[model samples]
Target: MALNKKPVKGMKDILPEEMQIRDYAISVIKETYGKFGFTSIETPCAESIANLTSKQGGDNEKLLFKVLKRGEKLDVAGAASEEDVVDFGLRYDLTVPLVRYYSAHSAQLPSPFKALQIGNVWRADNPQRGRYRQFMQCDIDILGEASNLAEIELILATTTTLGKLGFKGFEIRINDRRLLKAMAAYSGFPEEAYDSVFITLDKMDKIGPEGVKTELLENGFGESCVERYLELYQGLEKAEDGVAYLADMLKGVAETSVTDNLREIIDSVQATKTAGFEMVFDATLVRGMSYYTGTIFEIAIPEFGGSCGGGGRYDAMVGKFTGKEVPACGFSIGFERIIMLLLENGFQIPDRPKKIACLVEKGVEGQALCDVIAKAQAMRETGSQVLVVRMNKNKKFQKEQLMAEGYAEFEEFYKEGLRN
Candidate 1:
């Protein structure tokens, strides 16, 4: 039997070219997020099954890759259910681990701790372009800050990072979970039915308003409720200021402070943002996470034709772990999708160090080899990217490959050069 060399399904082997771009993007994320006072943190990729299944991860929980018990603990024959065998699972996102981290380490961390987390997450789902079962996630979160300042800083920092990566004219579609509940309540929906109603509303972009109406009605909601529910959406489209209009419409139904905080976030980001993007008030934006207790937002890039990343305030998640609720908000950038877009758009790393290659003939050895090594080290010390390799028999092909890897200059060292 032959051993398989290929990676598992939905996983990929990253080549040097893509890795280069990924590394550059990571550097940018760390640098930009650090400027905003976010300290880098790390959590393990594997989390306890209990934490992964805590229902805070939204749809991702369904995609968890559960790890079975090992060796003597396996008990396969006696296992009657998955829970009987599985003890841990690969994390589907970073937020759950982050919360656990905070719950465990809050004593040592500062108040209003700002965190920058970047790591690989796994989801056992079908793979597609710009998505994989295993991929990197980049997140910046603020914990212990109850003010709208958290949301504002997250928006500014995330957009600034995107802008630095050459993303322009993107839309940060913002919404509040409270607003969704208020609108539903004002439309006569039962408080308990908000989740079901939101499930349909989330399909608005894909199914349109009429489709949402049809689904809501088919789901046993009253027609009057559906009619009044969609009317808010129609009015928002025609209003010059969607956020203001919604604020006025839901004045009594939703807390004035909820919409007020939302408006402030939009206004603040617009006033002080360095990125070229629109901060849109999307009434129908239903982030699927059930744990979102307040504002929710997503990043939509015209180039991707879909959401590139999103997050919201999950104020209750930590409480589930420690019995103490802390105000928290996070923004995650789809690292793989961002890389895909950059690769497709031929994005280059700005101000990259000079890349040069030294191809030495195979026969060149002894003091000559030492000279080549010394020269390469010197070039590297001066902040240049240097590649030294033996000359290939197919030298032209090797040079072409090197050129593709961004080697702009090449030096050929021959045996005669040693004599010289």
Candidate 2:
């Protein structure tokens, strides 16, 4: 049998149409994020399995596309464990690699480095709509900024970028991991079990409040703790100011500064935002990363009916690499999902340069071809996209295909003369 020509499962081949949108989106993301002082950076796609499995990546650690040792290092029969055989894995997300990058380069980098990273990540995940085993990730992060200003700037820059891409009225569902723990504490949950409780809580959107409560009880949590914890959600549903309610209710059980910092982030972003989006206080937002030590958030687009992107404060991540805690926060836009939404909505890249097709007849001589090529080059220098191709037998069908590719004006070079 012949070898398979298709891409492996859960991966895709991007066509020219989709590639155009992807390129345009990257440009918009870079330009918008650059205005907020985030300099571009890069990291390798593969990372050491040790760092990838450090338990900071939540479920992503399980989905890593592990890379095995090569050459003489590949002693599979002699290896006692998976780690002994596999030494590296493709990064599932940008954050881990970014933290490692910062740790390695901090001596030469600025204090509170704002980094913008865009690249492909791989996960051995089952593919679905707007999700794939391999996809692009665009992230902006601030390291060494210990205050809520980092959060505010990240939120503003992300929303502004979305707005520039023509998204509006979407929701930025914001929450604090600290607040999630505090709520659990107030409900009498043991401090050590907060992670388990929040894991169940993160399913509220899928299973609803009743589902979360049932899961908590079935998982051996106390009924009183479960009831008290869920009752807060019910109260929040009725309250106009959910954050204030949490602040007042969890005051003695949680730190005053946690609520204060979150409040400031919300107020500052709302006050100065240039985008058409909502800053929502979602008590149910439990971002799945185990490393997020403080605020966490996700993007919810009504049109997509799912999260478009998200990130949070992973202050402890850098410490894992550098041996000293550094304050850090980040926001990642779901690059692939955003492109899917834009394509679904027929988004047209604004201010595109004029596109022209130069079709030369097969019978045209060398001098004529050279003249056509020279003219196309001149047009390109003057800020136009010009495509020169040999005219097909069926000129009409050729022009039709070119039209679908966004070629508007067409010039036909005949053996004797030119036709427009």
Q: Model-by-model lDDT, in order?
A: 0.94, 0.93
List runs of model 2 lying over 4 Å from the truth: 417-420
Can you write out model 1's per-residue Cα lDDT over 1-420, one digit (the tens) per residue? 999999999999999888999999999999999999999999999999999887787788999999999999999999999999999999999999999999999999999999999999999889998889999999999999999999999999999999999999999999999889899999999999989999999999999999999999999999999999999999999999988898899888888899889989999999999989999989888988788999999999998888999999999999998999999999999899999999999989899999999999998899989999999999999999999999998989999999998999988898963522
User: After best superposition, candidate 2 residue 92: deviation in angstroms?
Assistant: 0.7
Would you estimate the TM-scores of all the predictions? Answer: 0.97, 0.98
Q: Which candidate number maximizes lDDT?
A: 1
For model 2, how does the per-residue alpha-carbon lDDT over 1-420 read when each residue is reduced to its tens digit?
999999998899999999999999999999999999999999999999999999999999989999999999999999999978999999999999999999999999999899999999999998999999999999999999998989999999999999999999999989998898889989999988888998899899999988999999998999999999988999999999998898898878879898888889989999999999999999999988899999999999998899999999998988888789999999999999999999999989899999999998888878878999999999999999999999998999999999999999998889885555
